[model samples]
Every structure is written in structure tokens, then in C-alpha cells.
Target: MERKNLVIVGGGSTYTLGIIMSLIEEKENFPLQNLTFYDTDADRQEKIAKATEILLSEHYPELESFSYTTDKAAAFADIDAAFVQIRTGGLAMRELDEQIPLQHGVVGQETCGAGGMAYGLRSIKDMIDLVNDIRYYSRDAWILNYTNPAAIVGLALKREFPDDLRILNICDMPIAIMKSYADLLEKDVWELVPEYFGLNHFGWFSKLLDKAGNDLTDEIKDKIINGDFLPTDKEIANDESWIQTFRQARQMLIDFPEFLPNTYLQYYLYPDDLAKKESPDNTRARQVINGREKRVHEHCDQIIQQGTAKDIDVEADIHGVYMIRAAASLLFNLKETFVVMVENQGVISNLPADALVEVPALLTNHGPKAFSVGEIPVFYKGLIENQHAYERLVVEAYYENSYNKLLQALTLNRTIVSAPKAKAILDDLIEANKDYWPALK
Candidate 1:
């Protein structure tokens, strides 16, 4: 078997560490020839690079690894797979992440609505640069992007890159929630296959069934509404307000009875409530970010520090491991039927030809063959239309540097206030992200 070279952009990112750890644990199944880490920040990347080398050496000594500069010619050379997880700006801009949406009285999430548009504007140019670099260095390499504003990035790649360049955008929110749901149901997650669609974190599970063909949505819904479900973890549950958000959304689900909504849907589905100044403080976005994001950063810091001290634990808590497993099963083991995002190409029957829809797919050595989702609910279709338009505008704004298109994308976001407020926020965000973003007029 030929060895594969995996290149990780944004090497210092905690998510990258998680993926590396996952790969190490599954070393026997997917042995790597070489691992290369690339990041523009030398000091931060150096710390993670050293720590990763020490950790991998102690755990999986057979694989070779190195970390290098972000220079395209050096970092991307001869890569087989590239994992991208770059943040356009640093934690210094976190205030913008929180404040901008609060200014509009919305839920104020870091990766949705106004904040996400801001992020998209900044990230698009960098992502394109990296993508172009991959094509320049290794034209055949697969680019697995786990960036925020995933729908926009995916759209940009589809429009700009060659069809066979192999770009797949992913988010772990679905998998994370699915595991929690599986634990609540007392069933192995693998046994519960889900049929879901919509954009990234904003998606809903359309269908869920056990391997034996039993519908568990009702049972899960019952548990959620009754507040009988325990928190996924005590740390996450510590914030009482956050727990109530779940309870409130569960109530909404009971009322609708048509779909099971994600946590993020509250921002869109209840925009008035989420965006009202007097909208009785439910779980604010900061609470969730603090509870989840803070812990993740802490974990990464610990991993780097501990690994540097020779206390190496190369264990990864990443959903990408499951994706790799599914890919391997489909390609090597010849198993069929997994949910994946691929080109529409009549896969969804009704969705636009260029729209990237999530549906059941059959994976072979050639790649994924997406199956049709047929007709989705009217509400979902409406939501998809809004989101898809915003995403397309974002890509256009980035690729073309059209400020008007960027404003349109921001204004189109359900959580954004209106055209005027969107314009104000865009101005502020552009200034904040000047270093990362392309020059905009």
C-alpha cells in the first residue's frame, strides 16, 4: 500500500490537534507516510508543531512528521490530503464576534448571521489563497475544509476551483449532537442513521431511524420536551441558562411537530425573540461560546504543554475520524449508504443544479454519488433559499471584492437588523479584519 501525505493548514488550531490525535488512534487502519503542519504564526505553530512531534513520536513512531512555514511552495508540496481550519482573525476580535450581533439584539453567535458574514468576508481571500496553493503544489490532493461559514466556502470552491480538485466542507455540530442523542436513546450512534439537510449548523434532521427500522424521533422528542434528558456533560450543563435554551427549543419542536431543530435554529426561527432587547435573557451566545470554546482552547493548551513535557496522550476527540472510517468502509470495504454533502447534479431532484445538498451518497473509489432527497418541507425550502442566497453572495463578494454584494449577504442574514444596520456592522467588521481581509472599497 502506498503511504499518504497529510498536510494540515492552521496547524496551531485545536481542531487540527484533535484530527491528528484521531488519526494516531486509528494508525493501524490508515497509516500515513508523512504529516506536515503549516501556519502563518511562527511562535504559535512552533509550539504546537513541537508538541505534536513529541506526542506522535511517543505514540506512533512509524509515521514521519514536520511543521513548516505557510509559504505555499513549501507547505503544500506533494500533499495527498489537506485539512483546513483557519480563523481569519485572532481572539482579539472576539469582541466583534459577540458585540456586533448584540448591537442588533440578535442571538450573537460567532459563526452565524452578521458575525458569520464578517468572518466569511475575512476568510474567503485566505481560503482561496490556500486552495490555489494546493492546486499549484498538488493538483490531485483532496481539500477537506472544516472552516466556519462552511456553506459560503463550499460555494466559493465550487465556483472557482476545477471540478476534480476534491473540496469537501464539514462541520462537527451534527455529529456532536447526534452522539448526545444516541447516548440519550441508549443506542450506538452507528445504529441510528439520520437523513438531514440544510446549511451547516443551521440544518435539521429530517429523518432518523434505527438499523431495525424503528423511528426514534418521537421518543427523543418526548424526552426533550419532558426535560427528562440529562446534559451531555456536567460542564456543559453548569450554565443553567444554556440548559433552558434546549428546553425552550424542545417546546418549539412540540408545537411545530414537523421537524427537530438544531440549537442554532432558534436565532432564525425566533428572530424577533432572539433580536429583541427586552427578550428575557435566554442562553446568550457568549454563554455557549464560553462553555464550549473556552474548554476546547484549554484542552489544546494542556495538550501542547503536557506533550512538550513528555506526558503525551495522542487521543483525538474529533468527528472527522468517523468520516474517515465511513470513507474507508465505502471505498475499501464496499459498504454503501452514508449521508454526505456533494454536488446537486439532480441528487436532490428539486434543488438547483449547482446547489450543494446533503443527502444519502454511495462512495466508491471514484468518490461520492449523491442520491436525491426528493421534496423537502416548505419551511425548510424557504430557509434553504435564504441561506443559500446569502452564501452565494458571500462567495461573490469575496471573489469579486464587491462591497455591495457583501452588504447584500449581510442584510440577507435572518439575524441581521436591516440594510442600514448591516452596513454599519460591515464597516466596523471590515476595519477590525483589515489585516486578514482583502482591500474593499
Candidate 2:
């Protein structure tokens, strides 16, 4: 196997360690010559880097080299690929994103509706910058982007680099759901191929085909409709908050039995339910800040204080292995099928040709070629059309810096439909995200 050099762009993120651990596990298949953690936050990355350094020395002594840096040139130079997982304003800003929306009686959550719209605007500039740097230093390096608000971010990237096939935008939510289905079927997820279509975070799986070409969609639908909402392999399913989120899928199934809805639909389809249940002060961000964020940092601190990675509580981010595997498939031309966001170009017959849609695609060294989604039901198409308009406007707002475009984007959102409500949420988000978001005219 050919070893490669890679960089983790947002290396300071708590998700970094897990990705590193996963790389170590995949050494035989996709070995790395060097792994660099690049982040602007020197102080934060340093803690995680120190822990990682000790982690390497203790276990994979033969692993040649690793380093951490804030230097852009050094970070991008001569890398085979880059894995980006940036959260622009950190969890502090996420607290505001969630809190601000809930204050106005809207769904206060990351990567959905009002909160996601705000976060998307902040992410565009950074992601564009990172991709530009990667292309400059390593023109052919594949960029596996796992950034949030993927619908907007994916659309923005397409606009900035229209022809750069190296950038692949993906979300792991569908992957996690597949894991649950795999567990239910007593088979691995890789053995199952899904027939799905729609915008990121808003899609429906109509079919699940196995390697032998048997259809498992009916079985899965029955299980879901009958209220057997299973546990997923990702971290989200393990949490109490997420468990409640998953349980709501039962109601969604009972309501729309034709297909299994993506978990995020709970926010869009049942807005009243979310608005009533969510806490303005004690939101998801607060839970994460007090739960995983605190624990991850505290564990890093322990590793730092002890000056050793031994007994460090960092778990392998199995959830992240999909990105690396996708990268490997591309670099080696292994031709793996995975769901990714891309310009539709007739992949979904009903949608505009240029819309950024998430569909299963064959990933190779040449980039992704999406499998055809002939067409969707009229009801689903109508819902997606509204979302596409919103996503497009967000990108326009970022590029044009038009205040009206931003307002229109928010108004199109199901969570903030009224022009007045849209303005209320937008103003609060603008005030909260002043430092990160672009100045709208």
C-alpha cells in the first residue's frame, strides 16, 4: 500500500484525536508518512497536539512523523489529502446560535433552520480560504469536508471553485442511520447501498440494496414505522438529547409512511413541537458544552498535566473513518459508493440542474459521479424547492453581502417563515455573530 501525507485543517477540534486514532488503525490500508494538525488557535491545538504527541510515542513508535502548526504554507504543502472539520466560532458561538433562536421561540439547534443559516454564513469564508490554500500548495489533494450546515457550505464551495472536483462535501448523519440499519439487519453498512435524494439534512431513503441486489427498504420501513427506532453507531445516538430526537422518527413514520425521513425533519416538519420543547438557556449547545466539550478538554488537560498520553480517555472516532475511507477510495481509485453533496446536473430530474443535492455517488480518483435519482414525489419536491431557495439565498447573502438576501433566506426557512420572525431571528444572530459573519448591506 502507498503511504500518503495528510493534514487535519481544524486540528484543535475535539474530533481531531478520534480522526488521528482512526488513521493509526488504518495504517496498513492507507498509511500516512506525516500527519499535521493545522489550526489558528495555537493554545487549543497545542493541548490536543501535546496529547497526540504522547499518544504516538506510547503506541505507534514506528509512525514516522507528526506535528502541529498555525502556519498556512507548512500546513498545506505536499499533502496527499486534507480533512477539514472546522467550527468557525467554537462552541461559545454555538451556544449563542442555539440560545438566540430559542429566545425567539424557534428551534434552537446546530445545523438546522435558523441556527444552521447563521452558522453557514460564518463557515463560508473560512472553508473557501482553506480550500484555496489546499489547491495552491497541493493542487490534486482531495479535500474531505465535514463542516456543518453542509447544504449552504457545499453550495458556497461550488460557487467559489466551480470546476475543482477535489472538494467532496459530506454529512455523517445518513451514514449513522445506515449503521443502525446495518445493526438491525446483522450486517455491515458497507454491504448495503442506499437509494436516497434531497438537500443535506433533508432527505428520504426510498430503497436499501444489498450486495446481492435484494431490496431491504420494505423491511427497514416497516421496522421504523412500527416504532423500532434503533441505535446508531455515531455519538449522537448515544446521548439522551439525541435519543429523544431519534424517538421522534416514530411519529414522522406514522405521519409519512412512504419513506423513512432524515432525523433533522423533526425540526422542519414539527416546528411547533421543537419550539415548545427547547430551552432557551439550557439548549443543546449548553448540554454539549457541559457534556462532551468539557470532558474532551478535561481529558486533554489530564494528558497535558501528566505529560503522557497513557490512560487518556480519547475514543476512536469510528464515525470519522468514513471520510478517510472515501479519501482512500479516491486516491487509490477504489470506486466506493458514498453519499455526498454535489451539483445535481440532472441526477435528480425534477430539481434545477445546478442545485447542490446529496445523493449516493461512486467516488474514484476522478471525483464523484452520482447515481441517478429519476425523480421524487411531488410533496417531497415541493419541500426541497423551498429549502433550495433558502440555501441559494444564503450563499448570495454571503457573496453579495445583501441584507435583503439574508432576510429573504431566513423567511424562506420553515422555522422562520414570517418576514417579521425572520428579521427578529436574523437580527439576534447578526448581533451574536458579529465577529464571524460578513457585514450585510
Candidate 3:
């Protein structure tokens, strides 16, 4: 039971409080010698840091030391792991990421199609710098990156940090879906084992098994197709857009019943429908800003005013739980199986060896060892190949600062197949993200 030091990059995020609460709850298993919050925004991090200080004192007072800072050297110093969830330009950029595409009559999701491309490009430079900073201070620290548009960011990190294997890119959508599946089957989430494949936010679950190893894929698919599928988490289900996302997942299954599609696939599979449903005036970013963002900050204020979180409803969210659990698996050598993003390297026999793919892998002390997916069918292979090309082009576009490469990537994207429309959206995105993205040639 060796205690470890941890640093949470982007500690100003709405997720920071929940993650800190999770650390307190799992203090026994994933004991921490120190905890640090590192963020660029001092005001934003201060609220969470002050509230966390009060909560930790009230709950886990035995913790040795805790602090928050903007100093990279102080934050990353002597840390065994880093939970990285940075937003390069924050939610304002995200609002544009969603809105600009819709103005072009295209899907405007945070992590799909043209919007994901925009977000991915913005994330690359920051992620690269963040990783370099972490290595400079804590060379051996495990960097658990759960950044949005993980598909592109994952590939960019792989290309930039080829020899550095300490980085692990992950997304919680699959876990969230599995929680819904478990709820439908009347079982706890951990009791089920799922076999899935493809890129992050663009994957499919080929099989799901109960603890007894009973095949539950078809059963869950049947339920999803027949009934109103929604997230099991009450907090998520409350969001209207999330509800639509789950409902659209049901529609995808009815149309392509071969494998269970990721909820995000709805954005790619039915861009026109999604675009029609999306209101340009009120995008997902707006909803989050008005909803969770407001609530969490207010709640943190209340906790700080009260000087105790004992009365405040402090529940560790799925994202926080997943991150802490995954980090623990790596630190303690738990060998737990979790779906994570890793280099293809023949994991998908038909896909290129260099492509970054998301698959279930065993989390050992060294990092994730991905499971072999063998060769996929022609239909899936075609879709994945196209998507992978789009992802690769985004990375290349960033590195080479080539506008044409980005246009090609957006055109190849399923959401906006027309070259003309892709160019229009790319131009607007370029204007919107000029401050963050590299100057394109």
C-alpha cells in the first residue's frame, strides 16, 4: 500500500471537484501522499482548490499535503501520475466548434465530424506542451489523458512522443454505455465484460458478457432497438441532448444491426438529422455552461461558504471514478481490463499498424496491452479506414500547417462529404480558432 503523488492538470475544470472527491473516497486503495491541482486560470482553480481543501479537511484529514498552483514545476514535481483533461481554448471555443458547423448545415458535436477536427487541432499543441512539461518534472509519471476528441489527440501524441509510452489516452463513453447496458440487465456495471473495437467515440461493441461469460450483446441490442435507450446515470439522462444521443444510438442499431454503435456515431451516421435537431443559438456547450457548469460552481461556493462538504452532495461521477480506477490499476498492477485508446499495431488486423484505435486492454504497471481484434468486415473496415485517414490528416495538417490537408480531412469525414462545404466550414473554423490553431499555409 505505497502512497503515490498525483497532479490533476486542468484543475479548473468542472470535473475537478468530483475527481478530488473520488480520491478521498478511494484513499485506502489508491492512497495519495500528495495532491496538486494545476491549471492556467488562477481564479477558476482557486474556487475548486479552496472547496477541495475544506472537503478534504472535513473528510480525509489524514492526507499529508494538498495544494493547487499554476506553476508547472511545482505542480508536476515528484508526481507518480497526472490526470490531464485540458481544454486549450475552454468552452467558448467549444461553442464555436458546435455552432460553426451547424451554420453550414452540418453536425456540430464536440467530438465528432468537423467540430472534433477543430477541437483536435486546438488540443495538439497544448497536449504536446503539457506532456513535455510533465516529463521535464516527473519523467516517469503516468499521464492519463482523457481529453476530448481523443481520437485525433491520441494519434498526435503517438506521432510526437513515439518513444514515450507513459501516456494513456482514454474516453468514458463506452463505460457510460456499459453502465446503461448493466442497468438494463439488472446487474452492476462491473459484473459485465464487453468486447469492443474501433476508434474513440467511433467504435462498436461486438460482444458483451456477464460475469458467467454469457453472451449479452444481442440481448442488449434487442433492448436498445425495441425500447427508449437512455443513460442509466440520472444526471446524464436529465440532459435533453444526451437523451437524443441515446435515442439516436437506438436508431443506428435499427438501421445497422450488425454491431452496437457508439452513441457518438449518430453524429456521423445522421449528420443531417442531428443538424436539424440542433439549435444554433443553443449548442451543447451553451447547455453545459448553463447547466452543469453553473450548478457545480455555485455548489462549490456553497461548500466554501459552509467550510464543509459533509452536507453538500459530493458524489464521485463516472468520469472521476473511471480515471481514478484506471490510474490505480496502473499503479498497483491490478491488471484490470478497460477500453482505452492505443496504437493499432495489428490490433485490428486489417487497419494500418500506425493507426490509433480504441480497444479493451489490460492495465498493467507498464500501461495498456491492447487485445487483438483480428480482421474486421468490409463495411466496418471501410468506415474505419476513412475515419483514420481523416484523423491522420488532422495531425499532418497541424504539423505541416497545410490548409489543403485539413480541407481533405473534413471532406473525407462522413458528416460533410462535399469538398465545397468542408472548405466553407474549415474557413469559418480557421477564423474561429485562429488564436489557438497554428497559422495554416
Candidate 4:
């Protein structure tokens, strides 16, 4: 077993511990010669870095080495792989991203609608720089990016680093759904396989099978139509709001009983209902801030003060461990099938061949090659194409810094169809994101 060197780029993120804990637990599968945490914010990264130190020392002290640094050159040096899940503006910017749109009676989600667009605009630049740093220091290092607004960020990476095949953009939502499906069926997730298609956060599961290859789509669909929401995967279910989001899939299935819909689709399909359901004064950001954000930081403080994580309750992310799973696949050539975003090419006949889409792909040492989805039905085809346009234009808007393109992207969003409303929203977003987004004029 050849140990590898890996770095977590956004090591300060609240989500960092879950991944680090996962790596420690799965060291047998993906042994590491060196584990490094890299973040620009010195204060923010220190807490996570301290807690990670406790975790490593308490468990895998025999491991070669572990360190956290703010220097890109030092962190990226000699790394075989880099797991990138950067929240560019952190949670504070996320609050603005979600709050601004809801103020205007629209669905305000971190990774959907106007909120996702704002996040995309802010994220594109950092993603580009991160890729460049990784390539510069570790040219062949696999940049497994699970960055938000994945469709747009991934597309930008595809365009900006066209020849960098090692950059694989992936999302965990599909696998989370699969874990939920496995829970519903009372089986281990490994025993089931799902056939899914569409864009990130905007996809559907068309087929599912057991180890014996038993068809299970209709069974899951029947459960969903009857108001059976998937049991949240163990890792994410800890968040009550996330559990609620998981349950909303029931309504989605009732409306589109032909296939299982991503929980995020609720934002687009029922923007009015979603708006009414949310509390603008305290949105998901507030929920996270008051919940996971507060708890994790406090936990890290406790671990640091106590100088040991032996007593801290660290829940393993059963399904949210997309990075670890993908790394293992690449490291060992496991040929694991996962839902990842990739250049559409010929995967979806109707969508632009150059478009980046979220479809099932097999992860190998080289990267993911998306499975062909053929042509989709008219209803989904139209919605997907329109969303694809939004993603592409947002990437262009970031690159071109064109206000017109920014507004165009907002106008095409299913949650904000009117040009006037889109303009109004864009202006407000520009005001809120003035510090983060590019100057669009």
C-alpha cells in the first residue's frame, strides 16, 4: 500500500472536520503519507487545524506527518491529490446570498436560484486560482472539487483548464439520495446501484437495482408518491433542516411521479410555496449559523481546550464522504460509479456537447467519464437547457464581467422569470455582494 500525500484547500470550513474524521477512519483504505490543511484565513483555519491535530494524534499518531499552513506553495508542495470544497466568501457571504433573494419573495437557497447564481459569481475566480496553484505545485494532482454552484464552477474549470483532465468536479447530493434510498429499502448502500441523469442539484434517478440486479425504481417511486420521504443519510440527517429538505422529496414525487427528483428541485418547481415556507428574517443560513456552525466551532474549542478529541462525538459522514470515496477510486482504480459533473460531450444528445452536466460516471485513476444519457423527455429537457443557459452565462459573466450577462442569467432563472424583477434582484445582489463579486458593468 503506497501512502499518498493530500491537502484540503479550504481547511477552515465548518465542513472540514467531517471530512478529516472520515479520512482518519478510512485510513486503512486510503492511507496518507502526509495530510495538510491549507486555508487563507489564519484565525479560521487554526481552530479546525487544532482540532484536526487532536484527532490525528489521538488516533493515527503513527501516520508520517500532519500540518496546517496558509502558504499555498508549502501546502501544495508534493501533494498527490487535493480535496477542494472552498466556500469562497464563507458563511457570512452565504447569509447575504440566501437573504437577499428571499427579501424579494423568491426561493433563497445556498446552491439554487438567485442565491446559487450569486455564489457562482463569487466562486469562479477562487476555483480558477486554486486549480492553478495545484497544477503549479503538483501538476498531476487530482483536484476533486465539490465546490458549490458546481455546475457553473465546474463549467468554468472545464473552460479555464480545458486540458487538465485530473480536475474532477463532483457533488454528494446524488449519493446522499442513494443512501436515503438504501435506508428506505433496509439495505446497505453498497447493495444498491442507481442510474441517474441531469445537472448538479437538478437531476433525477431513472433506475435503481439491487446486488441481484432487481429493478427498484418503481418501488422507490411508489413510496415517494405515497408521501414517503427518504430517511436522511446518517451523516446529513443530523441537521434537522436537512432532514426536512430530504422529506420534501415526497411532494416532488407527487408532482413528478415518473421519476425521483432532487430535493433542490422544490425551489424551482414551487418557488412561491418555498418562499412562503421560509423565514426571511432567519433563513437556512441562520439555521446553519445557529446550528451546525455554532456547534462545530464550540466543539473544536472544546477539543482544543481539552487537548483531545477522544471524548468529542464525531459522527461519520456515511454518504457525504464523496471526496474520500472518489480518492479511493482514483488511487486504486476501483472503477466506482458516482454522480459527478463533467463536460456533456455526447452524454446528453440534446444539451450542448460542451456543457458541463451532472450525470453518472465511473471514477478511475484518470478521472470520470460520464455515462451516456441519450435524449431526455421534453419537460425535463426544456427545464435543464434553460438552467444550463443560466450556468453558462454566469460563468461568462464572471469572465467577461458584463452586467448585461449577469442580468440575463438572473432573468432566465425559473424562480425569477421577469426581466424587471431579475434586474431589481441583480442590483440588490450586486449591492450585497459588492465585496466578493467582480465589478459587473
Candidate 5:
């Protein structure tokens, strides 16, 4: 078996710890030849790199190499797989993530609405730079991008780096939700085989069936509608009010029989309503930044404080498993269905060919073959059409450096007040993200 050289771009991330742990747990299936960590923040990367080395050395000593570096060229060189989970700007910009969307009366949240758009702007340049580096150094390496504003980032990379065969963008939200549903219904995820379709965060469970061929949509719908489901303890749900909002959305799904709503749709569909509700007393982002993010940072601080610290026990988290599976399927020519973002390519008959759609795809050495998703509900078509336009405009704006396209992306978002309001918010975002974004002056 050929050894896999895995390079994690945002290796210092708390999320990375889980991915490393998962890889270790599944070492028998996917053995890694070497592991490397790269982050712009040397101090932070050093901590995770050290910790990971300690963990891997104690357990999987056969691993060929372990290195952490700030140099982009050195980090990406000869890498077979790259997992990207970078937040272009730190949490200091999170206030902007909230306020900007609220300015447009959009449900202001961290990763889903206008805030995500803002974050996307900041990330595009850096993501492109990283991808370009991989292409330059490791021409055959696959880039598994799990970065935020996933749709925009995926689309941007597809458009800009069309010839690059190595990039695949993924998100854990849908997968995580599906796993929760599976656990609730007492079935393995593989057995539940779902037919899901739509854009990034805004997607639906079109069909869900067990291995025995029993349809479970109605049961799942009932649970969602009646609010009978319990929040996962792993999820930081400190806000009872947010929980109630979820319940309300569930009620809407029940009342409106045609479409099943995703948790994120509430942000766009009822922006003004959710914004007026106070910020959740506890948000996942806050919990993560305060708890895991802080701990990771403190661990780094300790390494710096002591001049050097031994590698601590670390494990690959499951978050990056989807990417690993995709790569394995492609490399070994295994036939497997994985969720991927690609050009509609007629997969969804109703969507435009150019529009990027998230749907199940068959992976093989030849690459991803997007499977067709039969006609979607009319309501979902409308939502996808509206959001697809915004996503395309964002990519156009970034690539062409067009202010008009940028404004169009903002205007298409359901949260914008009007053309004038959209332009105002666009100006603010442009200014706020000036450092990270290309000159849109």
C-alpha cells in the first residue's frame, strides 16, 4: 500500500485534534506515511504539532515523518492530501459577522447568513493562495477543503482553478445532522442511505431509507415537527431561546407540508424575526472559542513558556473523514458514494448547469461522478435558485474584482432590506474585509 502524505493547513485548530484522533482510530484502514502541520501562527501550530507528535509517537511510531512549519512551500511540498479549516480572520471579526447581517435585517448568525458572506470575502484570497501553492508544489495532491463559506469557497476554486484536479470542498453540518438522525432512529449511517440535495447549508433530506428499505422520512419529520428530539449534549445549546426557535422552525415544517426546512434556512427565511430575538445566551462559536480554542492556545503558550514541551497525546477527529474516504476511493478505485459540491452538471434538472450543487457522487480513480437528484420540490427550487445567484455573483465579484457583482451577491441574500440597504452593507463589508480581500475599490 502506498503511504499517504497528509498535510493539514490549519493544523492548530481544535477541530484538527478530532480529525487526527479519528485517523489514529482507523489506522488499520487508512495508514498514513507521514503527517505535517501548517499554520500562519507559528506559536499555535507549534502546540498542536508537538501534542500530535507526542500522541502519534506513543502509539503509531511507524508513521514516517511529523513536521510543523510556517513556510507555505515547505509545508505543502510533496503532500498527498491537504485538509483546510482556516478562519481567515480571528473572532475579533465575529462582531462584524453578527452586526453586518443584522444591519440588513438578516438573521445574523456566525456561519450561515450575511456573516458567512463576510467571512467568505476574507477567506477567498487566502484559500486561493493555499490552493495555488499545492498546485505548484504537489501537482497530484488532493486538497480537501472544509473551510467556511464552503459553497462560495468551493465555487471560487472551481472557477479559478478549473484545471486543478486535486480540490474537493466539504462540510460537516449535514453529516453531523444525519448522524444525529441515524442515532435517534437506531440505525447505522450507511444503512440509512439518504438522498440529500441543494446548496451548502441550505439543503434538505429528499429521501431517507433503511437497509431493509423502510422509509423513515415521515418518522423523522414527525420528530422534528413535534419537537420531540433532544439536542445533542455534544452541541453547545446554552440558549433555551435558540432551542425554541428551532422548535418554531420545526412547527413551520409541519405546517408547510411541501418543504422540509434546514436549520440554517431559518436565518434567511425569517431574518428579522430571529435577529429581534436576543443573541443566544450561549453560541457554539463562543463556547468553542472560549473552551477548545482557549485550551489550544494555552497549550501553545505553555510550549513557548517552557522553551520546549514534549508532544502530547492527540488523535485524528472524524471531521475530516469524508475527505479521507473520497481520496481513498479515488486512489484505490473503490466505488463509494460521498457528498460533494460540483457543477449542477444536470444532476438537479431544475438547477442551472453552472450552479454548484451539493449531492451524492460516486468516487473512483477517474474522479467524482455527480449522481442525478430527480426533480426537487418547487419551494426548494426557488430557494436554490435565489441562493445560487448570490453564490455565483460572489465568485464573479472576487474573480473579476467587480463591485457590482459584489453588490448583487448582497442584494440576492434574503436578509437585505433593499437595493440601497444592500449597497450600504456591502460598502461596510468591503471596508471591514479590506485587509483580507483583494482591492475592490
Candidate 6:
């Protein structure tokens, strides 16, 4: 029952409210001594911080202190753990990430194909700087990074901070997927234990077991393959793009029933079909800006205007809850099993030892002890190798500013196999991301 101090790095984000609500909700289990919010944008952070102050006063006033600031040192100082959920260029850049690729008939996903590579390059330097700031302020502080394109970001962090075990790069997509599977099986998500393998947003569940150790993989697979696919989470279900993504996931499972496919695999496996359905003008970024972004900000404005959170529509979802619990596990030495991104080191016997792979690991005070995935079949191996190569080249391209390496990464990507298309996408992305990305030769 030891209380802890926490800081959420991206205080201005739409998702920050959810994390705050989740922290308040879990106060009984993971008590907080102090809570801090840090972001570069003072105006946006002020809005979120004001809403949070109202919510905390109305709900859990037990917190000893609550504050938000743009000062990195003030934010990082005395914090036991930091939840990093930053978007380097925000949604304006995400729109370009998705739109630019679709203009050339390739998948313009948030974390796959050319878009992911673009975002990944932009994210690398920022993440490295954030880590350095955290370490400088609190040498022992734990960093729970939930950044997008985690596959590339994770690899970059590993390379930069090889000996820093405190940084845990993670994504909530797998947990989101497991929630749907749990819903299908009529169980709580916590009761399910998944044995998974491969890269972030590019993995599969080999086995899923209930608390009693009953295998539920085949049952869930059957449900997905038989067109019983739908996200039980209301937030995701409300998004039409997410609904289509679920359907595509079902199609992937139907085509290859050996193991359950991650929903993102669809973007790579069926890029042509997905690309044809997309309107570059009305990309996923626009949907989010028009939908969740608009809704969250309006609710925050309402809470601020009313000076109370009693009737506000905002509430914590799985994304917030999962991150808080992961940090709690780290702080309290709970050793809970979670699927996190970590250096392979032979975890996946067939993949390169240095590759950053996502697998279930025991989250303890010392850091994650990754589970062994052993040798995968040739098909999955080939797919992961190609994706991993693309991820590696993106990281290399960022540091070296080698235009050719980026071209190679895009050409090898499953969503854009044509070298001509890859080159064109690269040039457009370079121009669009000139402000964020390093200049390439």
C-alpha cells in the first residue's frame, strides 16, 4: 500500500483525461502521493489540467498534490514512474501520414507501411531526449512508453539505451484485442493468459488460456473466423474504421487458421483491398479528429464551464486502466505477466537476437523476463523478417540520414512493394515531415 508519485508526459493529449480518471479509479490499489502533468503546449495542458483539478476535487481529494507544467525538470523530478504517451507532431502530421500513402495506392496506416515509418522517424529523437531528461531528473524512475509505431521506437530506444532496463515500451492494441476475445468467451480480460509472438502490431496469439489453464485459443479463433468479429469496447465499435479493421482481422484468421492474427496484419496482408476502400481526404486521422478528439475536448470544456465533473461524459477505458496497472506492477513488484516490446535475445529462436519482439513477460522490479517463443514456421518467420527489416532500416535512416535506406525500407514493406511507389511516397513524406524529421541526403 505504498503511495507513489507519478507524471504523465503528454499532458495535452486527448487521452490524458482517461489516464487521470483511471489513476483516480485505481487509487485503492495503487495509491498516489502526487500527480503531475507535463507537456510542451501550455494552452492545451491548461485545459486538461483544469478538468483534472475539478475531477480530483469532486472524486478523489486524497491526493497530497496535483499539478501540471511544461517544465521538463519540474515534471520529471521526484517521480517514481512516467507514462509517456506523446505524439511528436500531433494529428495534423498523422493526417499526412495516412493521406500521403493512399495518394499513391498504398496503405497509409498509423503504424504500418510508409506512414508508420514516417511517424517512427519523427518519434525517435524525441523519445531519446525524453528518456535522457527523465534519467537526469530521477535516475531510478521507470518510463512506461506507449508511443505509436512502437516497433520502430522500441528498437531505437534499445539501441540508444542498451543498459537502461527501466524503460518499458508497450502498446495497448494487444490488450484491446484480448478484451474482444474475452467478451466473445464471456469472461473478464484479466482472466485470460495469452501466449503471443512477433513484433508490435505485427504479432499473433499461439495459445490463450483461462485462469484455470483451459486452452481458449481455438474457441476465439473459431469465433473470429466465422464472422463473429466485433469489438466489445464501445469506443472502438463506434469508429467505422475500427469496425472494418475487425472484419479484416476476421478475414485474416479465416485465411490462415494456424494462429490468430493481430488486427494490424490486415493492413499488410490486404493492402490493395484496404487502400481501395480508403478516401485519402477522410483518413482515420480525420475520423479521430472529428469524432473522439471533438468529443473529449467538448466534455472537458463542459466540466470546466460547470466547475464540476458530475455530468461529464468522459470516463476511463481499457487504455488508461492498462497503463496504470502496468506501472503499478513495476512499482509494487507484482510480477504480472504482460505482453511488452523487448529485445528478442533469442526469445523468438528464428528471429534475429537483437530484434525487438513483443512477447508476454513477467513485469517485476528488475524488469521484464521475456518468455520463449521458440522457432516459428517459415511463413510467419518470413513475414516478421520483412517487417523487422523495414523497422530497422527506418531507424538507421533516421540516424544516418540515408535516403536510400529509407527507400529500401519502404520497398520491402508489404503494403508498398513497388520501388517506384516507395520512392514517390518517401519524397512526399520528406516534404510533409520536413519540420519533424531530420533532413535526409
lDDT for model 3, on a 0 to 1 scale?
0.91
TM-score (C-alpha) between model 4 and the true structure = 0.97
Better candidate number, 1 or 6, judged by TM-score: 6
lDDT of 1 by residue, 234-347 (tens): 234456754655665676687677777766777777766755632213224445456555555555577666655244333565365765554354335345556656767766
Model 5 spans with C-alpha error above 4 angstroms: 230-249, 258-260, 278-287, 295-318
lDDT of 6 by residue, 1-441 (tens): 989999999998999888888888888878999999999899988998999999999888899989999998889999999999888899999999999999998898889999999999989999999999999999999999999889999999998999999999988988889999999999999999999999999999999999899999988987777657977675686787888888888888889889988899998899999999998989999989999889888988999999999977777778888888888888899999999998998999999988899999989999988888899999999999999999999999988999999999999999999999999999999999989888889
Candidates in order, TM-scores: namely: 0.86, 0.96, 0.98, 0.97, 0.89, 0.98
lDDT of 5 by residue, 86-193 (tens): 888876576677677565555566666567778887788889888888788898887878888899888888888887766777776665566556766777655676
Q: How does each model score on lDDT? A: 0.69, 0.86, 0.91, 0.85, 0.73, 0.91
lDDT of 3 at 135: 97
Off by over 4 Å in 2: 304-313
Question: Across residues 270-362, which tens digit of lDDT does each residue of candidate 2 receive?
Answer: 997898898887888889888877777888889878987677666555467788888888889988899888899999999998788999999
- Better structure of 3 and 5 per lDDT: 3
Best-to-worst TM-score order: 6, 3, 4, 2, 5, 1
lDDT of 4 by residue, 1-441 (tens): 788999998898888888887887788888889999999999999998999898888888767999999998999989988998899788888888888888888888898989999999889889998898888889888888889988989999888989988988888888778888887777887787778878899998889898688998888777667656755765567777776777788877886877888888888888888888887788898888888878889989999999988678876685436679788898788898888888888899988888778887889987886788998899999999999999889989998989999899989999888899889889999998888888887
276 Cα displacement, candidate 3 (Å): 0.5
lDDT of 6 at 287: 89
Candidate 1 regions exceeding 4 Å error are 66-71, 228-249, 275-315, 326-338, 439-441
Q: Which residue runs of candidate 4 sit more than 4 Å off their true CA positions? A: none
Q: Candidate 1, overall lDDT?
A: 0.69
Q: Lowest summed-lDDT stretch of 10 residues in model 3?
A: 232-241
In candidate 3, position 267 carries an lDDT of 79
Worst 10 residues of 5 by lDDT: 229-238
